[model samples]
Target: MNPERTSAGPILITGASGQLGAALVKGAQAAGLAHRAVQRPAFDFDNPASIAQICAETSPSLIINAAAWTAVDAAETNQDAAWRANRDGPATLAAYAAEQHIPLIHISTDYVFDGSKGAPYIESDQVAPLGVYGASKEAGERAVLSTGAASMVLRTAWVFSAGRANFARTMIEAGRKRPELRVVADQRGTPTAAPDLAAAILRIVALIQRTGWQPHYGGIFHATNQGATTWHGFATEIFAQAARHGETAPTIVPITTQDWPTPVRRPADSRLDGQKLAAVFGITLPDWRDATRRVIADMLTQPASAP
Candidate 1:
């Protein structure tokens, strides 16, 4: 996509109902990127043919794939369905973009890593996914890269958006209903705000176009809010922040990952080192807590106050 032609042609955004997708639409408008967003039945993952058709019809210079099968546990038994959406959907989109030679900005998850490393995972680190969701996302990343679609795969973690059914929303609901809440403390990672991440996505496309970057130039990059925190610690911050906003907050009881005994195994340390995104895209992300504060402020004004 040419940065010069940005003002006229609308940007086609998929998964408009999701957190990241919604943020992209808002960000695009604010940045004067694009207004056209494709959602279910049109851009839905269940129908890959329809998805391809939408890309062809819109012919957007830039295509952002913000949709994915994000149900971590459900993916354990539903690997095929997950692959259909996560892997196959992007593969199809990538192939089309390659035929049209357009640029794509696809959002991915930090779950793609197994989290065995002691430090933050850099883009060059070896990937060893521990579960179905992670495996699917890893596969999708490969497909996007292999398709030669001039795509940038941004892997993020612990996403919490004010308008989505994410951690922050659940915390508010549970904190209000229960006097105390139990949370897992073993997993550690950054909490990325949808809007901040969305801004980074736009910057990636802009940087690539301005530099005459090629398809080989496209690779995996981590674009998450800085710093890391366990789910328990994250919940604590959310509750504390809510209290500051005059909302009732509950005590978060920290527990081990095993204590909570979930069906799916979560990465123990999903923190990603975003040096590559910073160096290549020329963008610096805010701290995770600061991003959370912005989300909480926006949540306070939400009429439905829901995800």
Candidate 2:
């Protein structure tokens, strides 16, 4: 593999408006790294010209692709849009990065696995996505890897943050109106804070730039806050954390996946094992509960209508 030529140009970050993307931009600035954040209209995945245009304009030395069509339920009826955004758009970015001879770090999801392993999934675990959303993301992973570019596909699970629509924000908003909340206890995965994930990504990038790309740096790796919990457990922690911020705690009812039905079937246990990331790059995210508290604090500090 050819080592990417380091340049003084800005690091290009896509999906700058989303939770993770926004956090990535913040992390980059705090690290004093020059970067350019791009989102829809100007950097749309559906519009191939927009993708090419941004690449030419920025002439980025490195690229972080955080853009995705993350509407899981909506993707059921909107397969075409999901594929275009999650699969096609990332493919375009991967190809561009390959041509430019730059390393690309693409954020992915644990949903790429079917969650039937009854144990934490490693990077090489078999993938059997149950919905179009996961399938598209899995396809995107393949696309990025197929480009033969120096790329890192980092898969995280149950992402949440202070910005945008996320589980923490949803639960907090619901607690304000509802007396009790029913969360699925059957499904299990790690609750990844966007800021924590963003920090990890930036660290990985810095390591690559510092030592140049190594053979082990390319390919898939699991990244999320340490530990795992069911959705019900996650909700309980959210309410608990919100209580510390003077918010009222709601009655959290633990229910099975069968209790609530959606168009898509999420994995029953999609917890990702993050050993490879730590072993390869000496990077590990903060504890899941600590990360959860940080995000809950951020949410409580925000205006009521922030989400």
Which parts of model 2 are misplaced by more than 4 Å? 303-307
Candidate 2 lDDT over 102-160, as tens digits, reads: 99999899999898999999999899999999999999999999998889999999999
lDDT of 1 by residue, 1-307 (tens): 4322322345678889899999988988888765579888777778877886787677776678988998899998898889988998989888877777677778788888888998999988899888888888899999998987777788998888988799899999888788999999889999999999988877766665466545444788888999999998899888777777788877788899879887778889989998887776667799988998889988977778732
Error of 1 at 267 (Å): 0.8
lDDT of 2: 0.92
Residue pairs with backbone atoms closer than 3 Å in model 2 (clashes): none
Q: Which candidate should be chosen as best, given lDDT against the real structure?
A: 2
Give the C-alpha miss distance for residue 255 in model 2, angstroms: 1.0
List lDDT for all candidates, in order. Answer: 0.82, 0.92
Q: How do all models score by TM-score?
A: 0.94, 0.97
